[model samples]
Target: MVAVRLSADSNGVLETPRDGDRMSAISRRALLTTTAGAAAGLAVAGCGAAGGGKQGAPRAQRTGEHSGASGARAPAKTVRLIGDGSTADTGPQPNQPVVDRLEPGQTPPQFVVFSWDGAGEVGNGLFPRFRKLADDHGATMTFNLSGLYLLPEDKKLMYAPPNGPLGASDIGYLSDEHIRMTLDNLRQAWTAGHEIATHFNGHFCAGSGSVSRWTPADWKSEIDQAVAFVTQWKTNTGWYDEEPLPFDYAKNLIGSRTPCLLGQDNLLPTAAAIGWRYDTSNPGGDQIWPSKRMGVWDYPLQLIPFPGHSFEVLSMDYNMLANQSHAATSSDPRNYPGWRSQATASYIAGFQRAYETNRAPFFIGNHFEEWNGGIYMDAVEETLKHIAAQGYKDVRMVSFQQLTDWLDAQDPALLDKLRTLEVGEQPPGGWKEFLGQVPASTATGGAGEGAAPAVTATT
Candidate 1:
């Protein structure tokens, strides 16, 4: 969940609008607060994130299992366990598409990333539900797992968040059973070709200890702790009988979305220092092509079309709920149907705006919760199915890491040209004419240039 500071005018209209006024007039129904109950409920209910697979494309065989071109079977996977045997170094991830540079005249794929926050199970079956949904639609996604979710409640004080109480976290720690479930899902998600990123731990979104005020050092400490929790879960839980997570998280973690979208400004410096590829913590970004921030990709939650409203909302489920039901988790049930439809339309509108025009990547953030009779979840499902029905080979539903792979493969000049496209604006004379002439000499640091970096299936 990204953090936002929205204020309405006397007429109750959102301020400082942009993207052709799409960001204007969002109803001032409620102040999107980061209350302890809301944060803890999101974590206790299901404190983790999710990933998906791309539709219409054949899943790639795991690297080390076959020759890339000849299709010849290769050697078996070699798994080397890491610290405390909580994680391992498996070969390339399975089902990863072979990323290549876009040829001249080739239109870029419509990349849609559906990420979950606080991705925990908690007996709700949402983790598996979305996993199955991704498989069914051939989409790949990013699951932002909260480190605290894996830390046993008994060991809660083990966490030391900056400026916050030692071992204190706004989000609740998971039960032992739920921790095991989260681990199981994470292992499966990794093997099945989804990206597992971090959501940090102890969501502190307000007051003096809020992540919004954390410094670079504080951010680094948080990141290090998050990594330790993920890599040392075995020590924390003493559940040696459980299977180790299938990938080396230290290497696999190339990106993250901060809790409640806080602390990104400080987090980016640490993220770049630690060699992370991207951060998706910025809120209220327009639906335009992304660019690097502090040398890392900045994939912000965008302002998208909101049905029945003159303004736009952040492309997130909770933001929608904030505008629709004023942040009340359980609103009037009779209004659920209309609210659900509005949410679905809003998502679809956001997708269509990007798909039909600038072709910027569409990102949607979610948490596994039954907010407002679970309409948001239903709306997300409907939106994914609708997108899948398009059946366009160029409409790629990929994870953040996978998208990074593609971005790194492109000519920087071509990317610059792509960035010129404003929200809902099309290429001057269509994609072929627009991107076909990007000078080969201008590739600069792009992978399409000489001596492309050695890319593996894992990243």
Candidate 2:
């Protein structure tokens, strides 16, 4: 079992008593009462450190290889469909990095997972724009696709979101042309070796019957609808000229981020039963190595050092916009430059926070919208360019699935030992003495991970 180290409040102030094991810069809501209390509270499964999964449900399968620094995918020999020809098994994925085990005496890779919500191609061309950006940086991101993006606006009434009126959504249905564009981008993204995860159907973030109050059963229905919409988009939209998405979404899909990052407690059981490998729906987490929740990987948006703020903020564009511009508007162009700098710096700071310390995987969430005259988009792009640059070659910008594979292949106890390193605290006695004794063979059992060149952290 991993020992508990330190617990800090939102402002990075340590308040919880420490036994020198695991530490967290978690928000008040995710903070623990004590050492054991925190471990007990955080670990919801009964499977000890390895964590547990659903009853009788099989574990999620690892499909892609960790292609190392090159991020190459195995070419598919032939294309074939599983059921209705909605998706095909196109040969090798073009840009995936094989998930490999860390070697002995190696420092952990400073992993940064860049993901998008409602990952669809709009008329603004952000989808293709970012896809190229990711490819250029050797980054493979998780695209949490909206189900209704495949269903045309004319077919809006087909959706049945829980508790809401039939065919309703906080984020409305997509137009037929937009759906086609979304499909085009999705196909291209899959070919480029990025992950296509779900964002659920009919994103009802709040009000009665929203995700905040959804149950396991409710989530199942939503998930089913989301899948059905994608696999049956041909029937839904009657567009036969386009080539089908080049992967069985049911098999390809192994994880998701919920609408607004709410209702994860109820979502996990459903996800586990369906053999999903991980969930990025967590609302508040730190830049520490992630632990499994309900036997599935819990990769959450971390709370990072927000410059000029008393408390840290979620490492997501939405939260940053909420803090910088309360109404999510950009009417005053005067604040654009400063706001852009702050947003960009926030992401860089979040990466540095983990990179310099625990080397926990940094997860940055974004959207396709050009919020604040697209300053947030610019901010994220700038951060990506720097982090994936030659100077920071050790930074591995991977998808959640690639990361989970690496994590699962690891010896759990070793992960617990890594957990003992507090945020920004190096190995107690350096790498040699700290990881002196290697454990028995597991999946590619190795002694260490790696890190990148340090980026300046802005407050």
In the order shown, what is each candidate's alpha-carbon RMSD?
A: 7.7, 12.4
Per TM-score, the best of the predicted structures is 1
Off by over 4 Å in 2: 1-77, 441-459
Worst 10 residues of 2 by lDDT: 44-53
Per-residue lDDT of model 2, residues 1-459, tens digit only? 111113545454222122232322211111100112232112110000000011121111111111121112334256676456677766555555555555455677888888877776556667777777776656778788888778877888898899888888656655666676677677666766678889887665435765768899999999999999989888777765456777889777889888656678999999888888789877667677787777777887777877776667667765566566642334488899998898888899888878877788998887766656888789889998878664776688888866776776666556766777765677766766665554644433222332111222211
lDDT of each: 0.72, 0.65
- Poorly placed runs, candidate 1 (over 4 Å): 9-76, 442-459
lDDT of 1 at 283: 58
How much is 145 displaced in model 1, in angstroms? 0.7
Task: Output the lDDT of residue 199, model 1.
Answer: 85
